[model samples]
Target chain A: MEAETFTLILDLMGTFAFALNGGLTAVRAARVDLVGVITLGMITAMGGGILRDMMLNVQPATFQDWRYLAVAAAGAFIAFAFSWVLHRMAIPIEILDAIGLSVFAVAGAIKAMNFGFGPVQSMILGTVTAVGGGTIRDVLILRVPSVLSEGLYAIPAFVGAALTVAALELELNGVAAAILGASVCWLIRVVGVYFKLNAPRPPRVEPGNLQG
Target chain B: MEAETFTLILDLMGTFAFALNGGLTAVRAARVDLVGVITLGMITAMGGGILRDMMLNVQPATFQDWRYLAVAAAGAFIAFAFSWVLHRMAIPIEILDAIGLSVFAVAGAIKAMNFGFGPVQSMILGTVTAVGGGTIRDVLILRVPSVLSEGLYAIPAFVGAALTVAALELELNGVAAAILGASVCWLIRVVGVYFKLNAPRPPRVEPGNLQG
Candidate 1:
């Protein structure tokens, strides 16, 4: 397949996975209706890309392509319809979430490079693309965003984005490079989840001296 | 002043107000450091406009102009330094927030109309522009967005946006029209706050039947 075609496929897959994950999370976390479920799902699936495109001053791919919306809605609907069953399969959903994060990170980095962003900016944008939707979802559900507090979420995405940027710099920009970057991200995230690891927290502060 | 110049001033004033409000909220709500305080403040000031520009497929004005960043940072720094005093002056800060909301709503509507959106789309976008930043800030601070739950937040914005759209439709598209729209929104919000009013809530649902 052409690189564009491959990227599109990966994007769609990530969209579906994120939508499903977001919908399931809403079901577990909040007392929302179908509209809320679908809205949250679509936001989770498409919010990151929209944010990325906005920063890049380009039209959002989610708006330009109907397939992205369709897939996201379908995934959300499936989760809503089968929440009872899906809620029990937490491990699988988490793995799918990891997949979404990895693909989005790689795709975001590549797109940033295509838009002439430097390596550091590309890497940061890539991580933002990967975590933005989940952060929004967490916020809507009235929770602290996992990226700010959880272990390995943004770290894996950042690492993946950096690896993708390295591949492009080394003139190894292809399906193989994408896979390599994404696989490393996925591996790190899965391990982090399995180990229940945590990123470091700030040292304790005095009660009334919270000033930075 | 020319309408464009008037609008620019209103936009900057709104940015400053939101940054200060965001910074104050961070100090009160989260045990964050200086970086967190400033990040949240900037996000609250600029996130809405960036989202609006993204949806409109235009370059974000925040990125195009240096003044926006400078003003936002200054406001955040002020809030950080004066949190002890400002936290006690809640009513004044709230009034500033209302000003930000009103101006943003009117400006967003005007900008959307200039971009050739229809009345309904313009109105919605305008409300989004007003509430979007606050929602993002609330999410980062791990609270339900006031727009989703509080009285008269989004409603006032929606009303202002609608009035702005109406003024545009009547070819009253200038500083006067902007002021008229913003004033009505500000009045309603202030009244709502004074009365401790609430928008209608969903009817009570049975426990365990929260499916939408």
Candidate 2:
């Protein structure tokens, strides 16, 4: 594969993993076969990028290209078909999630720059794009988004993407810059998960529990 | 009260009713408690508007004014407190829904215009803002959004908002023009519900009930 194509494959893999993550969450939520699973997968995979593009007055990059949809659909279909067996694999999914977070965050920042937004806005949008899909998934499933409630979920993506952009502005190659940023995001997520490094939860008063 | 404040009260009623509808949905889905309920209410009331404003490069109108948050919060509290009685009421949720649709669609369009978006984009954003919260809610919960799947849910808002903007541009007083547009939207919704109007459904194969 050409260099762009090689990078694109990693990007698609990340999308696939995110989509599968969304599908798994939907299954747990018992909203079986509602278009929610498919939508969730799509959102988790494409949501952040879509939000960034739309906000910057650009048509969604996914719409301009087709591979993103194919990857999301393929991932959800695979998960739906073999969920019984795949549910048992924990380590693979973990790795997939980390990769997805890093790639999506980097992609978000790059897209933002292409649309001419300032660096601060680009970083924020990139972080949002990276986690927005998962956040939407959790909220719809009536769970607090892990990004909002969990530790350091979106922050590392911001840091890495911002640093990568700064390096590129200092004349780094685009591919090298993206890989560098993606690595930074991935390392942070892996450490946060394995080491229990996460954000502090807000104090919440429990309401009187109603028996469902 | 000043005319604007009077209209604002009416606007608050619309927000209250809209948030109540969202809270009730969460309840019916068997999810409860204050945090989730409040979040749901806020999402339903402001999701669409936030998306619209962000796209238009303006801060969301709701976050700018505290009244919007207060109305949605109070609405959620009321819904939580009296859900049983409200659920048992003879009238359908559609009645509250119609009132909400009218107020939100009008308010969203007006806000967009105030931010100086062009006629086309303002109408588009207004329609999205009115339904955007619910869309995000459905996507998160993994259900097919009513706007995308249920047919005609958002079109009325689009039409009404477009008309409202056009009339305003034609030198109609803002209040009179908005009222006219809202009534048109309200009537469309009422008629659609009464007549069971529906949009096109996506093509799909049913699971395993096929005749051999």
Candidate 3:
């Protein structure tokens, strides 16, 4: 397959996975109706890309392309319709979430590179693209974003973005490199999830010990 | 002053107000360090404009201009240094927040008009620019956004934006018109805060009454 085609496929898959994950989270977290479920799902699926495009000073691909919207809505609807069954399969849902994270990280980095951003900026944008939607969803539901608090989520995305940037720098801008970067990210995230690992926290301070 | 200069002044004032508000909220709500406080403050100050610029397919003015960064940082620093004093001045802080909301709403609509967007789209963008930063701040601190759940926040912004658009459409785009729109929004918001007013909610449903 052409590189563009491959990337598009990955993007769509990520969109579907993120939408499903977001929808499931909304159903579990809030006393929301159908509108809320689908809205959250679409936001989760499209937010990162929109954020990235904004930084790039470009139109959001999500708004420009119909497929993204359709796929995201479909995934959210499926999650809403089968929340009872999906809620019980937490592990599978997590795996799908990891896939979305990895794909977005890789795709975001590549797009940044195409847009002529520096390696560091590209890597950061990639991670933002990967985690932005979930953060928004968590905020809507009044929870601290897992990316900021306790999770190996951002680290894996960062690593994936970094690897993708490095590959591009080394003139390895092939589909193979993209797959390798995403797969590595997926592996780290899955392992972290299985082991229930977390990034280090600040040393414990007594409540109200530090005034603003 | 030229309309351009006036808009810039309003934008800066709004940025400062939002930064202070965000920093104060962080100090009161979370046990975060200096970095956290400043980060949240900057995000709250700039998120709305960045979101608006993204929709308009333009570079964010916050990143382009050094003044915005300096003003926002200064406001956040002030809040951090004077948290104890500022915390006691609740009404003042709320008034400043309303000022920020009003300024952002009017300026955002005017910019959209300058960019040749339709009145409806401009109105929506203006409201988004007013509320986007606060919404992002609420999410970061893990609270339900006041815009979605309670408060007459979005309504006042929408009204201000509508008025701004109407003025522009009527070829009355002057400093007076801008002030009129923003003042109305600020007045409405301040009154709402004083009265503890809220938008109407959906009818109560039994717990778990509606499936996703």
Give one digit per residue, the lDDT tens place, for model 3 in B1-212.
87788778878888999999988887777755555566578789988988899888887767666688889989887877778778778998888889899999988998898899999999999999999988888879877787999989999999999998898789894677778889999999999999999998788986787764
Q: Which portions of model 2 show Cα errors greater than 4 Å?
A: A1-50, A53-212, B1-3, B54-60, B63-66, B90-93, B137-143, B169-171, B204-212
TM-score of each: 0.61, 0.57, 0.62
Query: Per-prediction DockQ, in order?
Result: 0.18, 0.06, 0.18
DockQ of 2: 0.06
Q: Could you give candidate 1's per-residue lDDT for residues B169-197 as a string of tens digits?
A: 99884777789889999999999998999
Off by over 4 Å in 3: A174-177, A202-204, A207-212, B1-24, B31-42, B55-57, B62-135, B142-212
lDDT per model vs. reference: 0.86, 0.76, 0.86
Clashes of 2: 9
Stretch of 10 with least lDDT, candidate 2 chain B:
B199-208
Local lDDT at B189 for model 1:
92
Q: Poorest 10 consecutive residues of model 3 chain A by lDDT?
A: A198-207
Q: Which ten residues in a row have the lowest lDDT in candidate 2 chain A?
A: A28-37
